[model samples]
Target: MPSQKLSTLEKVGFGAGDMALNVVISSMMLLITFFYTDIYGLKTTDLALLFVLVKVVGAIADLVMGQLTDRYTSKGGRYRPYLLWLAVPYGISVFFVFTTPDWQYSAKLIWAYSTYILMTVMTAGVGIPYISLVSALTNDPKERLSANGYRLFFAKIGAFMVTIIVPILAQKWGDGNPAVGYQAAMAVMAAMGIGLFLFCNFTTTERVVHVVEKQSLLAQLKVLLRNDQWLILCGVCVTGTVGYVVRGSVAIYYAKYYLGGDTETVAAFLSTGVIAAILSMVASTWITKFYCKVKLFRYTQIAVAAISAVIYFTVKPGDMALAFILYFLLSFVVDLHAPVFWSAIAETIDYGQVKTGKRVSGFAFGGISVCQKAGMAVAGGLVGILLSYFNYQPNLEQTQFALTGIALMFSVIPGFFHLVMGMLMFKYRISDDYYTEVKVQMRDSGYIAG
Candidate 1:
């Protein structure tokens, strides 16, 4: 049997994968919409279309990559090899997306679609495998949770770097051209992404191997459809992602327009939330040791909804101090569920296998990825539509209508989705105790080593 506990190096190595992924994930969530309109000169409507279409392609790519992982194995194991082979291509794709050409609107739109699609496909190639690595790393649920805590902490560190460094780099490097600055900044981020992926590939090992059965896609889908617990988790993923993406996509806009901040204020505002989220990862790991993770997941999200309502009502435009304080609180509370949620996905796969008499590992993770993309599509389209409806013109002094829309998007709108996410968790029955029971059954049945 493989060892259950991982060393700090492996944990940090595993986390570095997420930190790499956030080069694109964080940018898509936090900067893409702003980049497209304010920097790349796309209309809100075009931006909306681009976001939805790109994620649609990404969703399909996720499933394909999942199947590839299931079918292929190498000396490095099932998932880690992808990090080594594709890291350079992934970095190159990210760089190209930020590269704005001096072309007409029609040609530029085509460039946008091509580069964004390429980036999304590369993201799927690495992302699916990276997330699935947790299962192969260990059978112990506690260790998975701990590793995920490190993963999320580093993931937030990536976001912190983006919020703090990207703006400064862009401003200083662009000299007078914001577009040139953004391109240069993102190129640096992309190179860091390549290095992190290589580090993750070299330092991590897949020890707990599952014998993934060869099955047709349709057969796997049927088995997955029967997993009620997995289904519930999928629902939770969608709602939670919608909340995260919507709020995240609007944050820079919120700081710039509603809060009336310049580049410095925007960076500070975004950094506040990310720093709070980083603390949430640490606090969550410690809290789950004493508190029930499930109850914590459910309650914290509900509390976030209340906090969101408070922020919307209490903080007026230009209330920077109050906005920062409330935003920090909301960011911290909302993410308390993240590590629990990710670790739960692997548990759900085990639950499904024991219940359905088959193991569907890759596709299960892929399905979750698909759900995430769906949420992003919804959130992206919504942000574009709302901005257009609010008559938001880029880099312009805001109208009252535009300011209110930004505030609502940043707080109440996303809060409602999070409230729904918390309610959905009520249906998720997996707990540490319950998962222990699952392991006992799997062990006795000879599916895994005890």
Candidate 2:
């Protein structure tokens, strides 16, 4: 990819797509627990198990889609086809997942497996490839950062809005029936999902088209594993994701029980994170220009971990004001990593090609997606097991230990992952100079003008 800039129109569309993506994804993440237990009428343990299963299955689909994406090309190019193929179906499935009929737990689980699995396959297949397309879109390390950062900045805004809106919609709708609220919420979000995927597909075109190769399955896997930078960075991303999934998973609990609020209050707190994320990422554009990305990530991670630890100990049952304040600070630091890490992934595509003389951005990110799904899977199982062990009861008073346990999950788990991510990132070798060399050598568009 070269240093060419996306057009102003394309940029607007891309940013909108990013915003809608996060809005839907975060709304799901932020609300699914309550949805499962209350609206779907599934047991908490069953709900958690379902969450884990869907993520793991989706992770597997990500690998297949990634490989196919790298191997398959068309007039539309390597990745854009997925944006079209999966967009509508993905939205439909999301709606179904959110608003299944009230039935026996067994029947509900079956529907859960069916639509959730299908949705995961289509969405992950499309998403991993679509995200990887950024590598081929622009090779300017800075441009890549700006595009992804700008995208995330707006995405966080959408997430903030959805966080505020979804619960209210759920409440207003649930007054009639909780499932109906869930159904309405999903329908609205699905519309957004379908629209965004379509817009992103048409707005941006692919560059740096790879010569499609007929290679054995094993060969593709081998190529990806051989890329040293991808291996390390993907590993770090997985660990960080463990932290993220855990935090997101437990944040609901933290807000509701530890703070003694309802789900609506939890949504309000998450909205705070969403709001802070926008400002932080927008501010990061200046920081990215002056400061090294790895260094910024390191400082941010340490600060997040340290502050989280403090908040965990200091947050009292009544200190809602202080808790919100501390959480907002953590939110700012934590959101900073989204743009930095994703922008870094774009760089890894260049580094891998430079070192191996082969560009398999999809394959590289397939492995990347594995870490993400793995984190969710492990956290889901552990959370289920933890909830079961702690005697977590819905529609009743939660145990003190369970509340404390959930708080630790948010603070300690991500804290540890951040520590590991900080260490792994120190080894990332692609600097601005290295990226320039890679584009020049390949005759890619992002080669900075001399």
Candidate that scores best on lDDT: 1
Q: What is the RMSD, in Å, between candidate 2 and the native fold over all Cα?
A: 2.7
lDDT of 2 by residue, 5-108 (tens): 77766656666667656644675456666566656767767867787888888788888887788777789977877878888887887787786776777888
Q: What is the TM-score of each candidate against the true structure?
A: 0.99, 0.93
What lDDT does the true structure give each of the candidates? 0.94, 0.74
Q: Candidate 2: misplaced stretches above 4 Å? A: 444-450
lDDT of 1: 0.94
lDDT, candidate 1, 193-233, per-residue tens: 99999999999988887867899999999999999999999
Largest TM-score belongs to which candidate?
Answer: 1
Give the 10-residue window scoring lowest on summed lDDT in candidate 2.
441-450
